[model samples]
Target: MTLGEGTHTIIAVAMGVDGQEFPSAPVTFSVRLALPAPQITQPEAGSVQDMNLWIGGTGADYSAQVQLLEDFNHDDYGYSLVTLTGGWGRLFNLAPGVHSIVARQTINGRQGPVGIAHFFKVRPSRLTTVNVEILPSQEVKFSGTGHNGATVVLTYVSGPNNKPLPEVVVANGVWQISAPDWENGIYTYSAIQKVSDNAGGWIPSQDFQFSFPVSTKVPDPTNVRASADYSPIFSGNGVTGATVLIRKQDGTEAAPPAVVVNSFWSSQSRQEWGPTFDQIVQVKQRLDGQESEPGVGVVVRIAPLPPVISSLSDNELSPLIAGTCWSGAVVNLVFSDNPAVHTAAISGTEWQFRRRTEFAPGVPHTVSVTQTAAQQTSAPATRTFEIRRTLLKPVIIDPANGGEAERDLRVRGDRSVAGARMQLRVDGIDTGPATLTNGGLWYIELKGLAFGRRILDAQQTLDGRPSERSDPVVVNVVLMPPQFTTPQPGGDLPRTSTISGTGMPGARVDVWLEGRDDFLLRGYPVDSNGRWSSLVILPVGVKTLQARQAIEQVVSRDSPPLTFNVVPAAPYIETPVKDGHIGGSAVVSGFGVPGDTVSIYLGDTLLGGAPVLEDRTWSVPVTLTQPDGAHVLVAVASLDGFKSDRSAQQPVVLGRYEPSIDSPRAGSWVSHPVTFSGQGRLGTGQLVSWFNPELPWAPNLAVSAQGWHGLSVRALPAGGNWCRFQQTIVDGADASTISDWSESARFEVLDPASR
Candidate 1:
């Protein structure tokens, strides 16, 4: 039992124990039961308000209920526990006052006070306001006062239908209410009230309104007109970017406007790339985002020209190497138009043919192959198959009667169109024609054709009647005028260099370093992008540079000259001493270039110091010393700042020495590895040593965690009880051992069955 405020006591009858036998004896002891220092743990409102109080502690008698008095300090302060059980109790719905929590326990007709009392403040009572966010058909989150056990009601009349908006009970303080999928509209909720407020009385607040968003899609295109374009005819394909105009009724092919789909605008015609035709092109076009009617064929697919080589793949007739004797070497003529090459002529000093592996004996040779690709186009690509061999031949040309022409457009034709000396000419330009190649075959090509019409020339000598030329074909030339676009302000040169431009590709585009020599660098042809890019190799002492592209004309602007220093390479030391000694903590430096990496080493051992600075300067203290004797210290530097260099060996005596193991509790089961560790500075040379026990007459033993490490080990044949371990350290020429043969720990390596 406990007193209302002071000390209290408990009484009981008990017995003393003697060999588990109880002796008849009654005893009464006062536990001095203080309600373990009272602490108002919860209700952390900082101050008490209305009516709320919580008192917690230990050591309270479960037999008695606690009593709390309000206004204990005479200043209208009060406290109480109408629902007290054990020592934990909470009081809520309190009045404004300074309150204290006091409890006392009484037992066996005795009583004492509770540990301590507490104070709190409670002002007045009112409702708390909250800004809740949500919509009738949408979900939102909320907490505290009006949550859970809360009855929320929302009222709203559906538009037109004159119905109510669908509502759902809230869960986890979140509710979902949505109207049918709609088009850009707002959901209005007139009134929303929380009937079951977690705090008490019902709370009716304002309603929420939410907006439903609508998305749009692309619309069908109309009134579409075609746009003109140009492209290079690749080796086996022709340009195909021609377009046609389209409209719902009567829109001219030349004039067209854009269309709109849900406020988004799109052009009338859109084009891309597609297949090729016979040395010609087929363009496909359509209104952007619009599908053409079936059978209308309104899309444009432009054909891009094959890659250009600019110049022959690296200058050299035959697989040129260092040697001079190229009697038999296969040489492929180079051209800006390669891979899909259309023509090759074999003649002159380059005639003999040899594979890459073959070495030339003495004479020179050349070999070429002509191939015709079968695809979207009917153009026949020709390559000369020749071998420039010093060895004479019957001049065995495929079509002996037909020889090669001076220009790149010569074609030795075959039947369907056969006849001797077939007159070869296109657009009125005569291409020297030859006879029917050996076997009733004729050869010819469109020679010197004026721009526009493309046609293969007839095969005929200047004297005879010219053979009729193939069907006249239409062709288009690519022209992308290289414009000097003011470059995006060039950042520091290193970031971006060598500019580019466009012009007649394959034409040697000269490059010049403005205000410098012209012969220095001739710019190369612009790449497919109508542009060129190359590194600006600055001369040794020159830190500034500028460049311009000579594509037809200088199309590059002056680049600002920026100054920056080149990072100089560091120096290093080589050659290390075999056996060296250096005082630990002494400045151990290496020999190397001033700006290189220099490292310190005690002979083969490295003291590993921080990298040396640019001045070839580096210093580190060598705190480690060794036993006195003939010892050498060395310093090695490295070429790369990272790697260490060779050594600068210095022979010197280290120190007088004495070293040995101290403690590990002789003959212990070796709980932790039997360590032979002891204190000692570096002598001339120190070596901590341990030995393995012998099994019978055998000397070899397997020690676990070997050398310098105090590791444990088992005898070869497993176990035989008595195990011995030892260690030793040597300094300079002095050596000693620490082992236990007289008193060694005996441990049994239990067998699986025993364990």
Candidate 2:
């Protein structure tokens, strides 16, 4: 409950704890109603109306004189006069534009804080008609016609707010305003005329609305073409300064951005690094830093180059051009003078065609050919040759003479006439017939040949007539490559381990380490039993190696890579050995490589590190943080950036014999399952002898690395009991060290029924 707004008397009373009552002095005061300030209510904010206006609202005091003011004045004739009536008042004929009404009341001859009403406006008698127009550039132009010589005001209306437009001019009943740039959105405009005589009078017209929008036209890329060299070029038309984005179907950018200049844009040529299948290309335009919708896409196919033509033979009667291309591609031969187009039969990526017409000797003819695959044509491959018949030597098409070839050989040669059957001989031994194909080319395939030098020759018989034997083509047959049988891929290997593999007998094997390309020619000779082994010094890191066989001057392909890791040798803590005793600060010794930094740990507590000496030994002295108890420790060694695994933990006693009951000290009592924990100079796996009449020592209750051990007990009499502990370290059949009996530590045993 709140007290009324007035001066009043307040009193208070209190009651004592013993029923005594106390009362405060009586405060006298007077009560009076607090009259509210005046407010204007008639004309709403931003409303367009005639010159006659009324501003009024509830709130004013009659008993203590209250008054209202518009624009901070109620006495001057230039301002609105607020006449008070009953608890409400009205200010008549208020000025135009924005105005605020405020009310103040005098109480006890003191003026109170004024209360203000919502802003209001008053318009003149005649309104001005407003017209709005939007230009091509999205510029807004506003015009109006009002009273002659009247100062017409134009305003931009957005939502419930009105802002006056600057630089508006009105002459001879005409007024206009223009904005060079405007944002895109729906807008409302209004015009007001001041009557040209009254400075404060303004007549507002009805709202005129208009909308300015951004351009939505997106240009499509045109004339997209791919050249022989795989360079793709395209052009398009769009708004000036608009950016064109070209991308492939895979969402990867195909070319750099191109800015439109004078409504035209041409993209720079983009080349594909290798063969590409048919893919759809898309393009979009961006204007004023805003991207438009993507345009229609264009599908384009990029052709790959055909196999190279290694050599060509010249013939007077019929010139034959043969080479290799992609399988299923149509091969076309084009001559400079002849309109007749020649085609070749594609057989397993090989194409051959005959010129048919005779060519003059010493005359060079420009010839070009193309290959078409999947309806896509390749760039023209051109060559120039002269016709001169003088030799009948057979030429090897593949695996040129003196080069290495596999055991299975395909002997190919060119014949001058059709219906010619050829015979092939390898090292003077008849191999097989060289069947003539429809393309006037002869070839023979031989398999199961021994690995060595192969001398090949071909003899052709035309119309049952045998021709002289051709020249011999010598080729070296290489053996099968070696395979890695040890240290499989991703396997772990020692730092200095042997790499062995199987290869041809007596064949020298060359080891190539990854990232060490300069060791290509280094060879390790293998034994004559077709087995090889080599000692390699690998660094402590991930290593990869491959091997190849090199017999005489020929080298086979490299074997698959073998990836492995070279790890550092692990170190172990030697001193303060497992189950041993240590007191105060003890030296921790470990074995590691020279210069290795060994980190020591005592049950997860780091004890710093020490560098190993040249004798492959390291020692670090550490203070035991635990008091007279067993503990476990480990050691790790790090050399360079390679670190070894943590060594096996060593459990040892950490302090001397200074034992005391850790819990339930002297004069305190404990319950059953009495875990009597106390520290002593006892080694792990050692027993503590308890001298107490209430309890007996058990042989199996040996002290662990943590020093504490538990024993379960049944109900015991509630009374004081004394206990003592003694520890000794004993080797097999011999006592090495013994600690004196610890000082007597006493505690009371509680009854199980009362616990």
Candidate 3:
């Protein structure tokens, strides 16, 4: 039985089966089956108008899915699914005149018998590529024959991740999508037509993927980290020529570690290892490149070293025999920190580092961490890690001051640097400088300067980013006084504690103290902001900020101290601060020093002075005598005699006065002689007038002019006075022109009997 659009009960077993009647009280069918819904995502004929297929009757799917297939190449590949909405599916973009037949739909993990197949020819989609362009908004565009009404999808491919993002709709096959969200990273994107195949399938074009990562744009670089493994090494400061195997990423000898891969042309060899201990190894890639992200990554590996051994001088417990050459037996390797093993079986084994070395004449084999240092990570450490036995003496690195006496400056170092910090002191006083990262770029931000040479020093510790000053590195810095043009600056610019004056081609400028960082870009061009082409964020409040410059690199010089003053941003109320408004009084609080003046207002009227006390509190007495309506109350505060910014408006409701007309009620005609009166807040002196609903406004008539029977009235709280009114109408003239004429008592011919 077919049911209407409403709900209907479906029975697997009939209400009564084979002459056996089932209980009508509660009906339950034991038969379980599913019917698949037909999917006509693809059109059947080349240009079938009203086409439909019965992929499902009652025996198919009990809400099952039907999947159909459409193969452009006719290779017999049809997929299965179940879902059909909208009208019958029709094939699009059909060849001008070619007959094709689709049959045998796949459903519910099974193939069904071929239903009636239809043959038809399809003209190629009228959609011709009129034009494809990149929009100013960066969205790819597509236009063509029928493209005007076609659904288009834009896709982009990224090279760095080797994946493509989901397609986006640039427009409804019309204008352009101004802002494209596809730019999560550097990628190349293009638009394509998302049309249906004539049969029951979807067809995609073999168009070329957009060239990505957009050649002009670079993706977030891939971080590559490379390190070396050694059995034993020297003081790291003495070892001469050393050999390090370059380990690559893909178990090859080319991929290096700690590399920022951003471009397609940036292919590298996977080599594991480099030189060690006072030896130099070229990075093989661009030397001064930056990583995309702030974090470090291991993208490449160096070949495992053949294993070298050191610390032979410390083996005092043993002596050499009359004749013997030692292999790797006496001295063993210990690599618990940054460990490495040739194989999983060799992992954490003593043989990997085992060695045989003699102390001198006669002795027993020895192993001691006391005479040996743990692995040493030295400067220019591309992929090779420092592996020496250890002592408590940590490795210290310095910028240019030999790791000593410095002021208002930063020191750089590497290895075990994460969670590490440096401390700085300017001049002779300790001026807390900027903190540095594990990558070894320390900062000493300085503020407040006196022009001249200043000193800065730094110290560091792990786990905590701070400095107490162990190594004092000297740097010449200065605080240059700020200068501005004569025009009244519309906005207050930041107050910098630096003074800068560039000289001709041959001038020596000396900078010292905490302000030295500003001079780092002396040799380079500068931006309009007066910032050096290579300027970096400098530490604030650094001491001993000074700089000196001369006419030449070695001759007459000028030196001065750096003074900086950054104008703090003005603070305003983020949210309206309101207080209890009782008896027309409210207290407001602001974020500023106390003893400031504030203004209070009710509606648009200013009340009076509301000064903040030492506690930053300002209160004012405000009586809201306003009409019956919502009102906005405003309060403002000022600092240092500067013009104050108004606080957010506070919403409030003014008390309402209920008024009523008491006498000669409404609907009274103008011809009536009725008394008019009302109760209101208006005083006895307030003016009152009579009015009619027919007039645009109540007339301002005098007591004598209103009407002979009506009187001019005033509002009163207790009783009545000229508080009543009465009126009469004259037919011949307009009601407005007829003044209160008591003398004209004739609608007759001078006598009542004359009619």
Candidate 4:
């Protein structure tokens, strides 16, 4: 059907079989002229361009719009309205790809058919060269030359992923992009140049792959140190295979370059620099044609100077050897005649060393000293001096001529130098060295001295020279003091006590009382086996006694003072009369000296004690633990820390009145009435009772002097029955005492049928 280019309306009706017609609702529509397909004239078929280009076509209605399609998928790239003057239309920015384009036009809402497809391509941009550089500041920069006015798009390809990088526009055929924060590693990148189309849109090129290695910078030298010597050595740590350079603070080379091996580097200065002055230097490292910044300056110190010796006086013994040296230096001193060396650390600029061993008397001795600092030693300085010969003989102050000393004797003397060595001569034999006190007195302990008359002397040595022996002093090495076997310390003693002890035979012992010059017993005899005895009368008071032993005219030192109390008569225990019976708690009474305490004893065990009153009478309560047997007891009196000997023995007996059945032992079979017998305390009354599951009254059984007997029990039960007994003691007008019930004795009555 032919239609004009304008809106029009029409309607239709339905006709039935009987020739009757019904009109339908009116429908609206528009009629417009059909437009012809557009033709592309700008880009010929199969033609190629480096960037997107504008495409135009003719033969479309002037009022129609042209739509551009691209690629095999027929995607609409763009659309444009036809111009009224020439009936032509254009589309812009066709992307870079081998493409086929078909154009269609719509005139007054009526669409035309698609035109024939046109084949063309927008070629990818081109790049001639690409390079990657790592700046000194560790920034990564990518640069290349490509088509003019083209944008260089870079994508960092890491593993299987791609990251878009910032684009750079090419100017004068060159382009560059910087990644200032990129880490140090090998990196791969794919780049493409994007050129602008005629409509000012970008067209991407094919990917170009490239790789670059971003290396870490070389590290500066660390721990730079220099030794203080005539030829100093510099050392530090750096990267392996790198070169370390050292320069003075003034920028002049201080040492030749040294290559680092195993992260360590060392360089020695070629020229000799004396130890008189200090120097400062800097260090740097270079690796792979790259240099690192210099490190902090290091100072090299000067060597120490030789130690100086102070003036020395002649004839001085144990001289003070002092000198001056550099600060922080160690001063070493070596003696010419001695093989030992001594050293002293410097304090500030001064050093001192004292001579401990005395120098040879009356002979010149030389000593040399040197100072060392910072591993450098100086030359030696020397001094010479002599010690004086001034040793005096020592005189024996103790153990006078003809005096005696026992074993382990202490010998003392005087007239010796404070620090001089002293020795004793015993009967012409030299003993070991003695200890000298600060007051110029010397003493030595001599053990195991023989018992004989011995001559004693002493000698003094100073500055390695010994003086002649002092005037001879005769001494008698006698027996030690007698030890007392009786009357131990802090024990009681009576008048007319005999003091006996052991001592060397043939030696006589003399006993003396404290605060008295005269001996109480003199010339007491000592028997064989080193035994001695002395019978002396002591006063009635506290006494301290001492004894000494003597052979011929020499006497030993007095024995350790023995202290004891001289007590009077012993105490007497009167109560619990001799051989009397005791049970449970009992009273023990005794007679003692007034103001004394009496302690009672059973055998060796202490029962209890009581203080004596003004009447000289004492009583104490004692519990008896002895089982029904006879025991002995005694009483001792103590007064003023002195105890008297135990008094005469008093015998007693302990007993319990509990009764027991002896006849018809437990678990026995018997007839109707049971007979029982038992033992208990004499003179006590016992009661027997029986129970066959029921308690029954029984009669009291008398306990005579020989114990009780003949107690009978009667029961009719043909089964088990038991009986028990208890005791009581009744003494004139005293309350009765009852004992606990004894264990039950069970027995069975015989049944006639069963028997």
Candidate 5:
């Protein structure tokens, strides 16, 4: 049976072997074909587009095999196929050209007839460009065209920023939009066009990436000013309707932004002062709230009122000029006919300058003063004055009175009549006379005056007329002190040395050695020509010497103190006489120069050394651990790394230990308890004992490490009133190998109560 496109019901019966017919229940269902509506959604029918085309439509029931047919009904060549899971399908990559497209849907083994056919043309994109213009005012003009009258959208990117402009409809296949109030700089833009209505969304136009730059320079501010109260006003040129901003040198806006008009912008002067300072100010031009580069800067300085001249006067003696100016300005004073320019530093807004040179009497002078600050000089302020007459008196300018004077004494005085004759007197006797020069100075040299305090006076004479004598001056002349030529202060010298210096001729020079009680004087006669030399001996250790010279019964002051040391010539050995016994070390001592180090030697072996003290003495306990024999001991003094000759040799014996019992005589009385004391070489293991059987043996008294030992015994046997002590050398812990005991030292023990 063939099934039609409608609902149907049927039943069947099976014939039994007996030829009987049977009937069963029937089922009903509808038979419908899964046809699809294959209308193209993108690259709408008959629309211009690129070679990349999208063919898509609804599919047949549950599952269908969909294929795009090129040149439908004419061989029906398949261009693309897609397996549709539902009733929808799509295809891509259709050949470029005008073509009729048909989609077929097949389910199972049955294929449905092709759906409604769609037509389209596949070609390269013609939406190739979008042009944008950035005007000097920062306004942007954008335009673009796309094939098939596609819709276009404009967008630009600048400095990592992208912004989309208004969308426009294509008129005659072209679209344009104008954007205003953009910052001046380079910009890159892209035109996004929709060539057809498709689910693929907007596509960027090919070769349509374009860029434009705004080249307008930043507006510059000019004629910036500030009033005395610090109120500020500024103006500048900028794009019309742009906001002009004024800022201080610190980069903070000085006021709210102002709008530009007629290509010029200005801020109204406000009653309130802006940041008032003598500094540069900057302004920036902005378009549509976008800031541009900084413009040129203008300096604003609202200067204070001119400084006041409080005091300006001239005096003949100690001339002074003073005034006040701006707190930080320098005051310069220039005088007429004077090459010296005086400058005064500003202290708390006050300035002053003092002239060291005295102004001539009755002389007219003009002085001008000005202030300089911030590299700008003010107008000159002037003053005129004349020097008044001062007191006229001659002043002595030579050796001061009562002061030391040398030979060729220059007797000079000022305020004398020019070319006048001047007479000089010494000790009431006229020595010489001199004529004053044109500069009112008179001087004369006096010679051959006796050594002693002499009175000097001077008077000026003109045309045989004499003036009153000036005040007298007293001076002393004598021989200078003698100085040492060799051995300077603090120098080391030998005991005998010569001391010399130059002194007055035929004068008596005396040298003095500083002692604890007083300075000891040694008289020596000077040569005829003032040179003196003397030989003197200085004691060892630190000694001080001084010298002075007397001429014509006048003695000069003592010279400076010369302090020095006399190093020792040789070392001295005062202890350990010839053939003396030395246990371990011998005590060697003697006197030497101070600050010397004395080293003691036994034959060729150095024992020890000690530094010399301030009293010129040194002592050393030198070790003598040599073998048992006589040794020659000597000492050498060393000062400042230099060694003196060895002292006289002395003999000493070593390596002999003397052991003896010091307590209890040969026969003596003693208490009931007895004590034994002895001396022996230290570390020799010497032991002491008592050998009276009736008395208890005394405690062993071992020799001390420091050369002395003692022992006491109690509860001695009462019967034996006398006891004897004998010490012996022992070996090891036991009393074996003992040397012969010392001779007996006997003492008797007695009861204290019985006495």
Candidate 6:
């Protein structure tokens, strides 16, 4: 039960086993509210105080004791009790460096919750004569004057608090301590001198504090780099206001000292070296009379040497410019008359660049080359050379050197140099510049040349320079032969056809069959466009034909031979109608031209051939070898050596008619008259025959579509007998169309008494 802040009365009750209640005397008690924790109003948190300090706070209950707890501990040095007056209390004479104090209010053995913790620092007595020194080896020492025979205890206060230092004993009113391996920073320490009080205890005076900075060594230089100039500049980062020094690998100074500004420093060497020079050096910084350790080795490289040209004499217009240079250097070429600058990378010690455009013919040129490496350029190497005039001889393409040509001839040729014009020479007479096309092709037409053998040659000129005359093309200035324009070579033609060609205008074209001295068609006039046609009945054979043109009485050589075939008509297949079935050794008959030969074909396979009779009917025997399936057959007719096109395709079916016996099987016992059954094509008829020793010949039995119960044979010997079947005429036809017999089925025939 919780009690309120007021006076209350409670009664105790006693109960017996009989359920009767007895009441005791009433008890009265007073309930009072707990006093709130105090608030420290004087010497705020984080404030620095002197040795003789007073800490005060406000409280709600003036009659309560304000307990001040130092460093949050209840030990002898921390617990303190003080009486409050007018709701305020003070804690006096608190020793100090840094302190944390919490206050609580207590009344009648009841204490309230602790107040907010307050932290602050107390200023110890300032030591005026304290001396601090950092030795060259980074050791720190502290010394000061204190009371005679007193011992001084040191506690680290701030700045790099690594560990507690050892105590020092004062002798002759002086105390000193040395700390080794001290880092570089400002450090504050509190010193307390303790004297004997003659009661087996010592009294500690107020703290005497001191602070000092130690900087024994400067930092080493970083990020050191050098330029590729003859007198290079070395630069890096270091401590501000430090002097940076450049030194050789042997510890000798290489350049004057440079002061660091804004954490960066650079030093340029006073003396210069050759362009290809390189060296290794170190860098360091010094500040406040202390020097740092040397940095890593830095490489300094100078510019590359000038390149050397190999040679410059060549006949090619776009020649290769090659030279020797330092490995990994860029070689640059600059011409005196050309504005463009070309560059090439050195593969090893050599570099080369091919000019894209040709140099002017027979002109002197001066080219200078230089090598650059490590961001530095070298001096230029000079060379002068002239491009010699050496033009290739032109080549005549048309009007063959020893061939015949027409009087009004067109001369064509090609030049080695592009965009060069050609000049023609006929019979040692010069013809002005001709038409030149892209890709170095040139042509010129000469009209009405003398009707005799003529000499033709040409020369090419470029950029006002002439090339050597070409090898002379000697041609006969006569009428040119006609070229066949119809009935193309390797084509099939009818016996009566027209042949046409092109020749010189108004020329008389004479056409002749090959191997015939006499002309087949004479005096065919060519039209203005050099076209002529002749109608003739060609012989029924493959023939070669040629034509020649004659303007006057002189006839020119024959044209290129044109070969063609005069074919006969395609033959018609009279037998074996479309989609019909044929068996072994079937005869295929067709109708064709009287003297032509007809060849039968099954798919692409040749069957056999037969000549057409005088009555125009032909027949050929073909033994079918293909499996039983549908196939296509075609007929072609040939006369002389020319064959006609294939006739209309006739799709047909082929079958192998050998049948197998399934009942009274091979090697089985059977009675005198046995039934032979087998499987065969549904539309085919089967013929069964047996070899019996008692009979000279066995009769053939025909069965049509009987499936597996097809045939029965009688009169067998009382021993082993063999029987076979073959497909005879399909659809129950006669036996004239029979296939080869199948393998014999051997079976034992039992006599009637032996069954």
Give candidates' CA RMSD values in order: 41.1, 41.3, 36.4, 57.5, 54.7, 51.8
Q: C-alpha displacement of 567 in model 5, angstroms?
A: 5.7
Instruction: Give the alpha carbon lDDT tens digit for every residue of 212-330 in model 4.
Output: 77666666777789876667889987777888888998999998999988878898889888764457788888888888874657887756657788755433467777778877777
lDDT of 5 by residue, 1-755 (tens): 66878898888788899999887789788887556544445547767555544455554454556656655454454433342334343335543345677767666667766767777665435455667665445566777665545567665645334556877767786677886766656777765564432435444343344677655554443343434334666776667777777777777766567887876676754456533446676777777557766575767664434455667565645467777888777788877758787887678899887777776553456778877665556667777777653323455677688887644367778766544567777888888546554436767777556766888887776556677778888877544566666567877666556666776566677776777544344557877755677555655676787778766666778889887676556776756644444556457887677777899887778889999887566889865556555568888887665566678888655543346666665567666455555655333333333554334355455665444444445654443333333333332333222222343455565666677
Superior candidate under lDDT, 3 versus 5: 5
Please give the range of 10 consecutive residues that has the lowest summed lDDT in model 4. Answer: 730-739
Cα-based lDDT for every prediction: 0.35, 0.63, 0.34, 0.72, 0.62, 0.73
Judging by TM-score, tell me the better candidate of 3 and 5: 5
Q: Which stretches of candidate 1 lie over 4 Å from their true place?
A: 1-28, 32-163, 168-178, 181-187, 190-207, 211-755
Better of 3 and 6 by lDDT: 6
Ordered list by lDDT, greatest first: 6, 4, 2, 5, 1, 3
**Top lDDT prediction, candidate number:** 6
Candidate 2: tens digits of C-alpha lDDT, residues 414-507: 7434445667888998885566543235578877567788898777655566777877888888776776766677775555667788877667
* 1-755 per-residue lDDT for model 6 (tens digits): 89889999999899989999999999999998767878877676766665556577776475577777764574322333443353454336655356677777777778887888887765444344668876433457778887666678888877765547798878997888888867668888777876554447555665555788877567687788988777788898877788887889787887788998878889888888546455888787878877787555788877776889986656478667788998878889988768788897568998887777787654567889988876778889988877764466888999888998877778877755556667788988986556564434667888768788889888877778888989998887777678998779988876667888888877898898899888877888988876888777877877898888888777778898999887887888867865556776688986787898999999899999999997567999999887656678999988877888899898776756666667677789877556666665433444444643223222444555665453344466688777655654444332333444555667888888775
The weakest ten consecutive residues by lDDT in model 3 span 232-241
Candidate 5 vs candidate 6: which has greater TM-score? 6
Score residue 668 of candidate 3 by CA lDDT.
30
User: How many steric clashes between backbone atoms does each model show?
Assistant: 107, 3, 159, 0, 3, 0
- Candidate 3: C-alpha lDDT: 0.34
Q: What's the TM-score of every candidate structure? A: 0.17, 0.25, 0.19, 0.26, 0.25, 0.34
The TM-score between candidate 1 and the true structure equals: 0.17
> Which run of 10 residues does model 1 get worst, by summed lDDT?
233-242
